[model samples]
Target: MHRTLLLLVVGVSLAFGVDWFLGEFIEEYVVRIINLCGIAIILAVSLNVINGLCGQFSLGHAGFMAIGAYVSAYFTTTLRVLNTETGETVVRAPLFDGAWGFVPALLIGGMAAAAAGLVVGVPTLRLKGDYLAIATLGFGEIVIIMLTNFESVGAARGLPGLPNYASSFWILTFAWICVVSSVFLQRSTFGRALVAIRENELAAEVMGIRVARLKVMAFIYGAFFAGLAGGLLGHLLRTISPSTFGFMKSIEVVVMLVLGGLGSLTGAIVGAIVLTVLPEALRDVEQQAKLPGIRMVVYALVLILLMIFRPQGIFGQRELSLKLLRRLLPGGRK
Candidate 1:
């Protein structure tokens, strides 16, 4: 425990230190990309808990994230004033002023999303594989449709004028927490049960595992962090609408999980970073070559090649470690 606390403290320090450096030396665009990577890590890692570790097929991540983003944005918006360019402003007393308010807002957002997860998970989790996927996909679509028509939260226009509170420090802190928690979960008895269920649900039930309850718990857990990531994303973007949380958003996250290697946390992190950065790199090429759709073509080709060469994934249910690195190096393996 002492060692864990020490490592956490060090990590926090590092995050703050990096934030300071970025603020001082980096371009705003680069910093935004960095922050996006952090958010992607959170999303990918949280989804990995459900799809990878728990062996559940869920397509409702976008909906869960929307819940978190909207809920937290509501609170944060209530706390701040929106100044118009014409010098007309609506002022209201702060709910919980400054950065401290973001904590409660995000927590409430995550809890709301977890509750939604429970509602969806209880019945939907009974079905397996494609059935569960279809059910969750419907739920996600319903969420987007409802949000689109909800005028109180901006409806089709979406919410705007959000404060920028999702800094590198906060984003990285939450991401680190999510990753550490998942690692612990994967090592626990409950995690073993999940693995068993993944192998064979009938056999897992026969072994006395509470399959239903565990599946719901995993769903809720994943939803909570998805909410947190959503909150961070909304704050960073400073605007959000139903379109932002569409089915495609969920598919993108699943793609990250697949590209990284299902069931591998390290791979999730890697996939998130690579996917988040790859587009920007391609954008430069698209601009230089004056190709309108070349970026998309290249992206598709890369994914197709990866699927052909490494069907499982780049990591293929494995992780990066000192031993793995040595094995990959020439003349280093026995």
Candidate 2:
């Protein structure tokens, strides 16, 4: 079903998009929304490692992504993404054809984000409980404020001219990378260690698990994907504003976790996709005027109801596997 749905989506997108591109109507805007969904998946699932599996509440996701985006954008631009004081436009590279030039920029941007995960993780991972959350939140704020204050990088004005490279293809590809990497980690011994820590750091510590070290590793990896997502976001809009990676942005990522049920990577992906599509569907169909933020309000209400009723989430920790089928379908489960 997953494969079928994905193929159908791609086929429709290509058919409609090609027709639009060649027609007088210009292009289908839905492609951008699909790309946005792909990035959201990365942000939601990657954060699930520490926030969900490890039972750590983190809201600093946008900060890490911003770090990656700024660094990557800084280097990719002709100006080298250097912090600007005089307010400069981030010059875009001329596209070679239609896609390749912009595509490579995103890859380089993702690598830059991975590097930031390691750098920022080293120091901040030491704190625990509220202290850790505060520290991460502070880091995010610091990133946003720094970008806002740095006049050379355009300060609050934001930088523009980035190559819009985040197409449906790239978004889907990287989203898959995030999905596979996170799922593999969860099933591995190291992943289980994260679970151990999540359950009780004191117990994990007594058992000789390097709790602090694992937390840092998870944070860094999470930051890496967040950054990659930011890169995709920047390219999608062709602009980089300091406010783009704000605390509220981080909260949205958390919402995906909450809606999908904490600790389930698959849940996070589902939540992200559902939310992404909901907005588009709502905008297209809704006739009555509503608050611009109504979507989030609805999301919040749904989350509240989920926590009250099915607190374990859509599947909880029980992953989707063929093993479950054996008991229900006799030979079919196998």
Candidate 3:
């Protein structure tokens, strides 16, 4: 326990130190991509709890993310007043003001998404595989459509001028918390029960596991984190539209999960990092090759090759650890 605590302290210190360095020296464009990567990691790992560990396929992450983004953004941007002398817009929030408001706004957004998850999950989680995926996909579309038409939240136009409260420090902190919590959840009895349900639902039920309840809980859990990621994204981007959380966004998250390796937290992190960085890295190649849409082609080819050569993904069901590293080394397996 002492060692674990020491490691945690070291990890946190290192993360904060990195965040400070990035803020002080790194360019905004690079920092933005890093922030997006952190958000992707949160989304991927959270979805892993449902799709990977629980063996349920869901595709409505965008819906939950939208809920969190809009709710939190709205909460923080409730009242806006014009400064007569300076002609600057001043924000006055009912609950809290300025940067401090982000804390409660994010929580409120997460809770709202969790509530939506419960409403959707209880009935839908009973369905299996493609059926569940379709249901969740439909739910995500419904959310986008509703937001697109809802005028209060700016409808299709989106909300703009949001305060940029999602610094690298906060983003990294939340990302770390989500990763650690997921690891613990994976080792718990609840996680085991979910795994059983994933492997064989009927057998798990016969063994006295409440499969339906667990499935719904897992869905809610995933939605909550997705919401948190959404909040961070909104703050980082300082603008959000209904179209931002469309069907493609959810598909992107799923692709990251699949690419990383199902049922592995480390895989989720790796997948998120790779996918987030890959597109930007490909931009130069596309520009030099005089191909505007080459990145999409590259993405397709990568997935195809991955499916053919390593269907289980880069990590499969395993994780990256000192033991695994040692075993993978030459002449180290004994």
Best by lDDT: 3
TM-score, each model? 0.93, 0.79, 0.92
lDDT of 3 by residue, 95-168 (tens): 55677788899989999999999999998966899999999999999999999987666789888877878988
Worst 10 contiguous positions by lDDT, candidate 1:
78-87
Between candidates 1 and 3, the one scoring higher on lDDT is: 3
For model 1, residues 174-247, the per-residue Cα lDDT tens digits are 88888888888888998888888888999999999999999999999999999999999999999999999999
* Model 1 residue 215 distance off true place after TM-score fit, in angstroms: 0.5
lDDT measured at residue 173 in model 1 versus the true structure, 0 to 100? 85
> Number of the top candidate by TM-score?
1
**lDDT accuracy of residue 274 in candidate 3:** 98
Off by over 4 Å in 1: 79-94
Instruction: Rate residue 299 of model 1 by lDDT.
Output: 81
lDDT of each: 0.89, 0.75, 0.90
Ranking by TM-score: 1, 3, 2
- The deviation in Å at residue 324 for candidate 2 is 4.9
